[model samples]
Structures are given as C-alpha cells and as structure tokens.
Target: MLKNKKLAVIGVGKLGEALISGLLKRNAVEASDVTGSVAHEPSISRVKERLNINVTLDNCEAIKGKDVILLAVKPQNMDRVLKEISSSVKPDQLVISVAASVTTSFVEERLPDGIPVVRAMPNTPSVINAGMAGLCAGANASEDHKSMAEAIFKCVGETVFVDESLMDGVTALSASGPAYLYVVIESLAEAGVKLGISRETSTLLAAQTMLGSAKMILDSKQHPAMLKDMVTTPAGCTIDGLMELEEGKLRVTLIKAVVKAAERARELVNTQTSKFSK
Candidate 1:
C-alpha cells in the first residue's frame, strides 16, 4: 500500500527511526523517497548516518510533497511541531500521529479541514517489527485513510482498530506495556540467579519464555487463563509459582499499573485537547 508513497517522519527519534527502518527493511518505501526531520544539526548527521535518508533541520522542508506525514514528536512537543508544519500540510496528504495522549481531533484542529488524521499508539517493539499498534481515525478520516495508516504500521507489526475513546487504555496497556513486561522478565531472571543459574542463561530463559507464552496466546487464540491452566496441573511446580504470583498480588498490581497509566494518559488528553480545542 505504501510502495509508491512518500513518507516524511517528523522527529527521527528512536521510534521514528525504528518505523523508518522497518519500512525500508521490508521494502515498503525506498530510502530515497523517505525524508526525516531532526531537532538539532547534530541529529541531522545521526539520522542520515542511521537511515541514509534525506535529513533536514526544517520540518517544513522534510514534509514538502510527502504523501504520508508521521508525527513522531513527543506529546509535550506536539503543539509546537503541529504549529510549525500546519501551514505546509496539505489536505490531500495523510497525517499519522504516534505521540501518546495526542488525539486525532487534537491534530485535526491544528491542521486544515478535511485532512485525514490517524492516531496510533505503537510500542517500542516496533523497533524490531514485532510491535503492536492500536489506531483510531479522526472525524475526517475514511476507510481508505484508515487503511493507509494501517498499512504503514503493518510494516512494523500487528495493527488493531479501536474506538478513539478506548485509545487511552491502549496507550496504557500496549504503549507502556513493554516496560511492565521487562520488569516481570527481570524479576524472573533474578529468581533464576538466586537459584545459582548463570545470569545470561537465566535472562534468556525468562525472556524467551515470555515471548513463547505471548506467541501461544496469539497463535492459539485461547484465553490466557486456559493456557495457564494447561501448565498448572494438580499440585505441580507451575502451580506453586502461580501461587506465589497470586500471593504477591502480581495480577492486581499489573491491573492497577495499567489503570494508573491510563489515568495519566487521560489527564494528558485533557491537557492536549485544551490547547487546540479553543
């Protein structure tokens, strides 16, 4: 879907670089057709060296004539970047914003009317083409527009469409999920180390187990609890471990963590919308 499209990524940070790298690696877009904008002169060289794409300090220059513009800026900097490129963004082009807590309406309000805006929350795993993204379309967006946006994210990993209202939950569960999972993996690895296992092997076991478990969930399409039951036989070692997790309130802790993150993301929605809703 994006083979012929011109992609302009504003803010060639880690996520941006990862997306560009995924697109290029998958031959979705040619390096020559991609352009990226960086905040500093030094970053210009860094992005150029990393992606070998056209790098510019000017956001306008980077976006000029682009078919799809990915706003990869931080949420706090969204307003400034939107204002900087608002005059240059054409209605015919598609705008995809990956900034957490920044809504499609927020981008739409700052841009020309009829411009299609897609709000996507993709996690750090996108850097490796194993990412998960949840997307929602703005009022002006159409099925075609959503497809275009989906195609872009598909280059990196899975994409799911959800109601805009549920995006805060997606942000909390997926966008912030990797960090939480990393903590779990680290704790598991630590448990192994305490048992006298080598740190490297312990880490590999913990990380791969997590990956395999996630894959089973996706591929089998079964309830995670069912899968957990499969390993947790009568009075088994797995049950003992599960008991410890339950005793430590791991499940509720994770649920509360996601809830807390969603609260913060919702708060950001208010802060972000108030800026442009006026």
Candidate 2:
C-alpha cells in the first residue's frame, strides 16, 4: 500500500519519531520519500538527523504533494495544525491522526470537504516495533484509504478497525495501557527486592516475565484465564500469589483505572467537539 507513496509527518515528537523509524526499518517507505515537520527550529535538525528525511518548520510545506499525512501532534494542538494544513491537504491524499481523543470527524471537519481522514491511537511500544493501534475511518474514507492507513501502522505492529464511538475506549485501553503495565512490573520488582533480590536483576526478571506471558497468550491463542489456570497447580505457590492479588483487588483496580481513563477521554472529546461547534 505504501509503494512509491510520499509521506509527511507533522509534530515529529516521540510518537512521530517511533513511527517514521518503524516505517524506514521495515522498508515500508524510504528516507527520501518521507518529510517531517516540527514546531521548533532545533527539532528540524534533530528529526532530520534521526530519520534522515527532509524536515521543515512549515506544516504546509511538509504536506505538499504527500500521499499520506500523519498528524502526531498533541490533542490540544490538533485543531491548530489541521487549520494550518487544511488548505494544502488534497482529497486524494489520506490524513491519519494519532492525537488521543480526536475523532475522524473532528479531523474531517477541519480539512477540505471529502478529504479522507483516519483516526488512530497507537501506543509507546511502537518504539520497539510491538505497538497496537486502533483505527477508524471518516465518512469520506474508502476501503483503500483504510487499508493504506493500516499498512503504515502494521509496520510498527498490529492494527484493528472499530467504530469511531469506541475509539476513546481504545485510546484508554491500548494507548494508555503501557504505563499501567509498567506499574505492575515495578510492583513485581519491588516484591523481588523485598525478598533480597538485587533491584536490577529483579526488574529484568519482572519485565521479561511479563513479555513472556504476553507472548504465551498470543502464541497459544487461549484465554488469559486458561493460561493462568495452567500456571496454577495443586498446592502451588502460584495459587498463593494469585490469592494475594485477588485479596488486594488488583483486577478490579485495573478495571476501574481503564474505565476512569476512558471517561476522561470522552470528556476531552466532548469538550473539543463543543469548542469547535461553538
């Protein structure tokens, strides 16, 4: 889908860098085919050096003649960036937004009429080529547009399509999920430290275990509960640990955390939409 496609990335920040780097690493697009733009002059050189692509300060210049434009700007800055490039973005080109809580309709309204927009929520794990992205297409986007957008994200990891109404929940779950998992890893490492394990070794053990466990679920294609049961045996230490986790309400706490985050994301979307509507 990306063959011979010229790409533009606005707000070449961390997520932007990770995405562009993933594309280049996967040979999805070449350094010469991508243009990146940053808000500051210093970032121009930084992004250029890192991605080996043309970097510009002008969003309009960066997007000119590009086949796909990826917006990696902050949620609050999305409106400003969209308006800045609205005149230049063509209907033939696809625009993909990774700004959290921003909907495809939110992007479509700010662009030229009938321009295709794909809203995506990708996580930090994309830095390691193991990200998860949730995508939803605007009214103007065709299946081809969606596929092209999916190809870009697949370079980093996996992609899924859902209705726009579920996107904020996707943002809260997958995009915001890494931080939650990190807390779990940290707590596991702390338990190791309390048991006289060195902090460094404990952290490595905890992180690797998490990675392995995740791989098991993916590779086995079994329910997580089934996997958990497999790890528990009659009078096993694993069951004792699971008991402590249940007693501490870890599962419920996690469920509540995701729900709360989703609620906040919805509020932000409502506020942004209200502001634009006004």
lDDT of 1 by residue, 58-145 (tens): 9999999999999998887888899999999998899999998888878888888889999999999999999999999999888998
Clashing pairs in 2: none
Compared with the true structure, all predictions reach lDDT values of 0.93, 0.93
Candidate 2 lDDT over 1-278, as tens digits, reads 79799999999999999999999999999899999999999998899788899999999999999999999988888888989999898888899999888888888888889998898999999999999999999999999999999999999999999999998889889999999999999999999999999999999999999999999999999999999999899798999999999999999999999999999999998897777555
- Model 2's alpha-carbon lDDT is 0.93
- Provide the lowest-lDDT 10-residue window in model 2: 269-278
The clash count of every prediction, one per candidate, is 0, 0
- Most TM-score-accurate candidate: 2
